[model samples]
Target: MRADPNLYDYWPYRDRPKIVWPGGKKLAFWIAPNIEFYEFDPPKNPSRPGWPKPSPDVVGYSQRDWGNRVGHWRLMELMDRFGLRGSISLSTALIDHHPEIIEACVARDWEFFSHGIYNTRYSYGMDEAQERAIIEDSIRSIQTATGQRIRGYLAPALTHTERTFDLLAEYDFWYTCDLFQDDQPQPLKTKGGRLVSMPYSLEVNDVITYGALAMDPWRYADVLKRHFDQLLEEGERSGTVMCIPLHAYLVSQPHRIRAFEDALAHIAGHAADVWFATAAEIAQVYREQYWDQTVADIEARGLASGGTGFGPAED
Candidate 1:
């Protein structure tokens, strides 16, 4: 196990170079809808079991099946009403499993980035050949399906190996949502190409709010509004990024769907200083405008080395 993954430096939030997003917006607000496919019975990794219960895991798999069958359309239509396009964190195999969903997002011109082959197929204990194979497969699949070369990565079920970031760099991925270290994009000390860690807010994520925190519809709506309010205020000093990562199965349920709408209305209708952006768009601007200066600041401050995880990563 590594004592330090050494992914990035200690970048302070208080004062550094300023960022001005497109249209001079104070905050970059993007939504990541995790459009994923889960297998009812998937191959197991040596390090972790694929399913929580016994084989088949019918109840668990069916709920996610609901996400594709019913929840996804509900969620997409709602976003459409807001003129919002999804920056999808995709389980790439969904293209074959559910081509209709992929086609719909493509029609909307939503961004598609890799989230591995399937939510159930984790990357733990894989060798270099195996890991690179999956990355190659994802690139080929997404390009073939959507005519969009994937530029970002979020590991399957958040599972990763020691070489994950390095491999992402080698593949020329622009950003990764796997890191929760900051609210703004920061440079990753990769073994290869330039990559940034785009903020994919776990705190306000629907999966966290609904599944982990057990928040009701109204509370989740309130939370989103409040979260945005603070970030927008802070963004005045320098740009901030706000992402509400979502799972359709959790947030697009009949009872919960309106809460999702309410949150978007508050941000889209009530705010003027927000840049409604795709994750890739945000990554491009950051790399062009802020990358050099941010790297210099880290070096000047002597803050260019830190550990990524306390223990070896399981996901």
Candidate 2:
């Protein structure tokens, strides 16, 4: 069977039901700091290249390594300054190599979720057994080290197979950051159980803005402010979610960190209007209050028959 191209129902954004966040807040704002670890000479997958240049690329390896060694701390300090907590999209092996960084995040009461064992590792071309083992490794390693059961996943480098969602549900994951289709949480069509697609921004992400768009810090800051402004305004009528995806290597440089901080300050200033939340927290509340209604609305619109789940709910 072919996959559904539109992951969710065809609900027009303007006409959808208003989502009222707790405390009548307009926006659900969260930060995801991608605390990653990249191996210098990773095993290759048929679907994707491990590095842009070649194996043992010193410049590429060291640049990403700097995020772990130096840049992450600088980014964490600024998060502290704004009293913001991160939901870390972590590489599982980082717990072994840089336990101190994980320890610091734990101390700040931040949430940790799997981004696979290594940033260089891709989910492409994996069989069901291999994928399941990776999920189990992540769950076990994180629980053993940090004493928290991870409930979210962002596929490494955003690579995934059809079974990815099914496996995540079986392992009891609550949310996924892989889908960029909506500005609000939506029920996902997984096989074993329920999953929520959290609003994770690709456009506002540091890697895209800095690397692909060639945006300088000043322009980056402006774009962030503008993104927030539009969302805040639209959110007054219905609740919206905004995520700022950051990589320590890209945003934590001395030249760029201050501008990023300034943008954070601007968003933080509107504390009364937004609820600063983790992805799990947002998913939990939506599951409790809105999931059934959303499902029902999709059904009413005649758009709920396209999923590939294992049971009768799927077509």
TM-score of each: 0.95, 0.96
Which stretches of model 2 miss by more than 4 angstroms?
A: 1-6, 309-315
Candidate 1 Cα lDDT to native: 0.90
Q: What are the per-residue Cα lDDT tens digits for candidate 1 across 1-315? A: 766677887788999788888998999999999999988888877777888897698888889999999999999999999999999999999999899999999999999999999988889888999999999999999999999999999999899888898899899999999999898899987766879999998899988889889999999999999999998999889999999999999999999998879889999974579999999999999999999989999878987554343323322
What TM-score does candidate 1 get on C-alpha atoms? 0.95
Clashing pairs in 2: none
What is the per-residue lDDT of model 2 for residues 1-315, given as tens digits with 9 covering 90 to 100?
Answer: 444544456666776777888999999999999999999899988887899889888888998899889899999999999899999999999999999999999999999999999989999888999999999999999999899999999999899887788899888999999999889889887765678899999999999999999999999999999999999999998899999999999999899999999899999999999999998899889888878888888888787777454434445
Q: Rate the local accuracy (lDDT) of all candidates.
A: 0.90, 0.90
Model 1 residue 81 lDDT score: 95
lDDT of 1 at 178: 96
